[model samples]
Target: MKLIAFCSTGMRVAAVAAGIAVLTGCGSLPLPDKPQRPMVYDFGPGLPAASSGPAGAPLALAQVAAPAPLEGLAVNYRLLYAGSGQQPQPYALARWSMSPAQLVSQRLRETLAAQRPVVNVGESLAALELRVDLEEFSQVFDSPGASFGLVRMRATVVAPLTRGERLLGQRTFTARQPAASNDAPGGVKALTDATDDLARQIVAWLAELPVPQGARPVAPAARP
Candidate 1:
């Protein structure tokens, strides 16, 4: 009986030792690496206040459409080598807060709202419609380090007629500004400037269109 009890106690001790060894081995194993955080950027406050233009009827602005790349929030850059074709690349660690198209639309709406009543495409009482197609929004590197922010978009204005919606006017606007640095922040700054310029141009263009009959009149100028 004594011999059997001693053997059972030995076995229990061995089992506990094995369990301790397994736990120690687990503690020594390397842990998974933590993920790195990416830098996010956004266009600063939209372009300076454009000259107040005569407001026409309420205008509806549609969501801007862009290519697959510009439609994302990634910060994209283009390398313009002498031989290589234009292939855009996104920065691995840098990104935009919102897609370029969305940013541009926001800027346009804010800038235009200062001068006239602006509404979305689905608004019930919109008198005129504005549509924009974004072609390019990228930082083009001329050489290894030199770069500029380029923006190109086509704008169309339509007015509802007795028959149907009639195309009032259409135009393409382009703006390029030299980047202050060869980094994402610089690119964002330049792009914001370009967007502001585009907004000003669009506002001017809308001002020249003849107001339709029964359209709302321009809002009274603000008191100084």
Candidate 2:
């Protein structure tokens, strides 16, 4: 009986030791790598604080409108080298922080604010309203090594009436800038440059437009 008991104790100790050894080996086994996150990009910090001076006519800016594809945050591009009929495609590993329309709208407001008091729709009574329709905004590749960013938009300025609004002026603005490289980052930079140029064009257009008769007068500034 003493011999049997001793053997049983020895077996239990060996079993415990084997179990610990298996657990240690499992812990040392390598784990699968984590999936990589997609890269996100946006128009870098916009222009510095606009200088304070005599503000231009108060202008209400409506939310920019875009097609279904541009309404998403995808960084879109086209490969002309692939085929002339090729459709635009979004980069798989890169995306914009906001939809193209939203980015353009933000850019417009920032740029326009420097020349005028840009406000949201219905924010300013009897103010001229600027509405933008974004038609095309993407990077187009001319060759495997060359590409350009294209931006096309239509803008309409309208003045308020007692019951509705009367159109003051309208124009289509298009701008394009060559990509520094044939990559997503290069495309984004080019797009930004095109947008800035488009904004300047709009400013010049607005300055040339004559205020129409029968339009409501600019609203008085509210006293703080």
Best TM-score among the predictions, by candidate number: 2
* Poorly placed runs, candidate 2 (over 4 Å): 1-32, 84-86, 217-224
Per-residue lDDT of 200 in model 2? 88
- Lowest lDDT sum, 10 consecutive residues, model 1, at 215-224
Clash count for each candidate, listed in order shown = 0, 0
- List model 1 lDDT by residue over 105-130, tens digit each: 99889888878888876554666778
Q: Candidate 2 on 108-218: residue-level lDDT in tens? A: 888988888877776665358788999999999988889999999999888877666678888999999999989899999999999999988998898787766566634
Runs of candidate 1 exceeding 4 Å displacement:
1-34, 46-54, 214-224
- Cα lDDT, all candidates: 0.80, 0.85
The top-ranked prediction according to lDDT is 2
Question: All candidates' TM-scores?
Answer: 0.75, 0.80
